[model samples]
Target: MGYAQLVIGPAGSGKSTYCSSLYQHCETVGRTIHMVNLDPAAEHFSYPVSTDIRELISLDDVMEELGMGPNGGLIYCMEHLEDNLDDWLDEQLDGYLDDDYLVFDCPGQIELFTHVPVLRNFVEHLKRKNFNVCAVYFLDSQFVSDVTKYISGCMASLSAMIQLELPHINILSKMDLVSNKKDVEEYLNPEAQVLLSQLNRQMAPKFGKLNKSLAELAAHVFQMSMLSLLFPAKSMA
Candidate 1:
């Protein structure tokens, strides 16, 4: 049973940086962790990849030859990867032993995680291969400072959680760069009562009744017992 982290986030949200830092952290603690570059459009990276998806298909090659834009080309490249999972991905993963720790540095495409079945199918393939995979969803720490943005981030995380049906871990990345950590840290493990108060303050007076309902809903959703809690209910087994 191999352990794997599917590092994912919106573009420029530090998925790659998180992977690099995590890799370094593992090294400092005398642990072995292999990183696989799953971003075909990635031009640079801090960590060396054990296996690269670009070898099978690249956005540059797809775009230059097929005349697709950057986004479309990357989607095409990922779709191509999905098609070759049994062949190319299998060949690359064959070298790693069971119980190996792998970090897949995936593309920063939001659509891939939100609604697309490509990544979902890819994860299913990993499970079939006996990998205990965790989806580490990173959000820029700056975005969570405000109540509205925090809610949006939470919803996005929730969407991914429901879509993939995996053990999800939501990470507020780039914490070191946050100057006003106090404001942001408050939202990390926010209480339902606090969220309700914040929502009431942010909404208009005309929406007082609506805000109350929204607050109750938000509170219910954020409760520890909620089925769709953004935070994973239990430790990964």
Candidate 2:
């Protein structure tokens, strides 16, 4: 069976950079991997793309023709992709061997992963093609610096996990940019009580119940094996 990683995150969260880094790392380790560009709006890529959705549908062409904005055009591009999956995606998959590993650098639209059925259908299509797929979600490491932001990130990740229903891997990207590693580490493997106390301190007493509930949920998500803290410095090494 083939192996695939669905690399997804918000815009500017470093999804493309991570994919490029991963490709370089695999090359150094003498492992072969194919990169697939799923972002219709992607202008350039550091890594060579084995398969590109832009070949089938482009955001620029869609926006210019349909007179849609970036967000709407992106959604339109993805929907168009979904419609042609059987024909276009199947032909692309045929180029690779059954054992080949593919990394799909997806668009950064949060709506696509959270509520849309596009990604879910894409994953199912991969499965039908005998590929084991896992979603690698990236969150900006700076979000961990604040208790409220940390909770928001966790909720977003959790939403994707629930929506995609895949073997999920949450990655906190841009660790190298973080100033205080100690502060970030706490939330990496946080305890329920610790997070609750921190949340309580950050918010007013009026938000006590909301803070406690959020902390517990965040703590549970952090404890899962799927949630991994990737340090880019060591990851590239």
Candidate 3:
């Protein structure tokens, strides 16, 4: 069976950078990994894409011709990709061997992975093609320094899990850039109570009860999702 990694992250979270670095490292080791660009709006790329969604439809063309805003245009482009999966994506997959490893560098739009049907449909198409797919999520390490922002990241990751329900790997990217490594490293072995206490201190007393509930919920979800516990640091497999 074929294997795939859907590289996903917020804008400026280093998805493209990760893909480039991974491709280069693989090349150095004399290993071949196919990189597929799924971001129709992506104007530049660091890795050579084996198959680019832009070739089928581009955000620029959609925006200029349809007079849609950037966000709307991006959504349109992705939906168009979903619509053409059988024809274009299928043909592209046919070019690869059954055991080939593909890394899909996807768009940075959070909505696409959270609530949108586009990526859900896209993953379904891959499964139908006999590929075992795993979502590789990149979360900026800076967010971990602040509890509120860290919780926001968790919520976004949880939303993605709910939407796609794929085997996933959560990565705190750009660790090299984090000036306060200790604060970021703490999450590697997360203590829910400590996190909740920290979160409550950051917010007003009026939200204390609500914060507790959210904490319990986060703990429960993290355990059940098993995403956080599964990997401290991982390479795509």
Candidate 4:
């Protein structure tokens, strides 16, 4: 069976960079990992794309032909991908051996991973083709500095975990940019009570109930008992 990492995250969360790093990492370890460019709108790429969806459909072509904006054209491109899965994606993936590992560098669209069924359905296709798939969701480390933002990140990750129904790994990216390492150290395997306290100190007391709920959700999400995985990267210093 094929092993695959479905890399996804919000825009500027380093999804492509992660793929590039992982690719280089695999090369250093003498491992073979192919990258698939799933984003039709992707104009430039850092990693060598082993297979590309643009071979089948392209966002620029869609936008120019349909007069659709970026958002609309991207959605159209994704829907077109879904429709062509049986024919196009299957054909592309079939070229690889069963044991080949593939990293799918998806579009940095949060909604595509959190709520959209397009990717969910795509994963199902991979499973049918005997792929052992894992979803690696990335969030910006800078965005998680504040308590409220951290809680929101947790919820967003939890939503993707439940929605994808695949092995999930959450990564906090851009650790290299965080100057204050102390601020980040406190969040590693953070305690629910401590998180609530931090939020209380950051926001108005009137938001206490909201903070409590968010904290509880984050606790449940981060709890060792949960299947959800958390990965925090240190600055590459």
Best by TM-score: 2
Report residue 91 deviation for candidate 4 (angstroms): 0.7
What are the lDDT figures for the candidates, one per model?
Answer: 0.79, 0.89, 0.83, 0.83
User: What is the TM-score of each predicted model, taking all chains together?
Assistant: 0.86, 0.95, 0.91, 0.91
Give the per-residue lDDT digits (tens) of candidate 4, residues 85-157: 9998888888999899999999987778888899999999999999999988888888877777777788888
lDDT of 2 by residue, 112-220 (tens): 9999999999999999999999999998887778778888888988999999999888888889888998978878788889988988887899998998899888888
After superposition, candidate 2 runs with Cα above 4 Å error: 233-237
TM-score of 2: 0.95
The RMSD of every model to the true structure, in order and in angstroms, is 5.0, 1.7, 3.2, 2.7
1 or 4: which has the higher lDDT?
4
lDDT of 3 by residue, 1-237 (tens): 999999997987888888888888888898889999988888888779899998999999999999999899999999988889889888899999998999999899999999998999999999999999999888888777877777788889888978888988787887767778898767665567977898888999899888887777666655664335222222332
What does candidate 1's lDDT look like per residue over 131-167, in tens digits?
9988988888778787778777777777788888888
Worst 10 residues of 3 by lDDT: 228-237
Compute the lDDT of residue 154 as modeled in candidate 4: 82
Q: Which stretches of candidate 1 lie over 4 Å from their true place?
A: 204-237
| Total clashing pairs for each candidate | 0, 0, 0, 0
Q: What is the lDDT of residue 234 in candidate 3?
A: 27
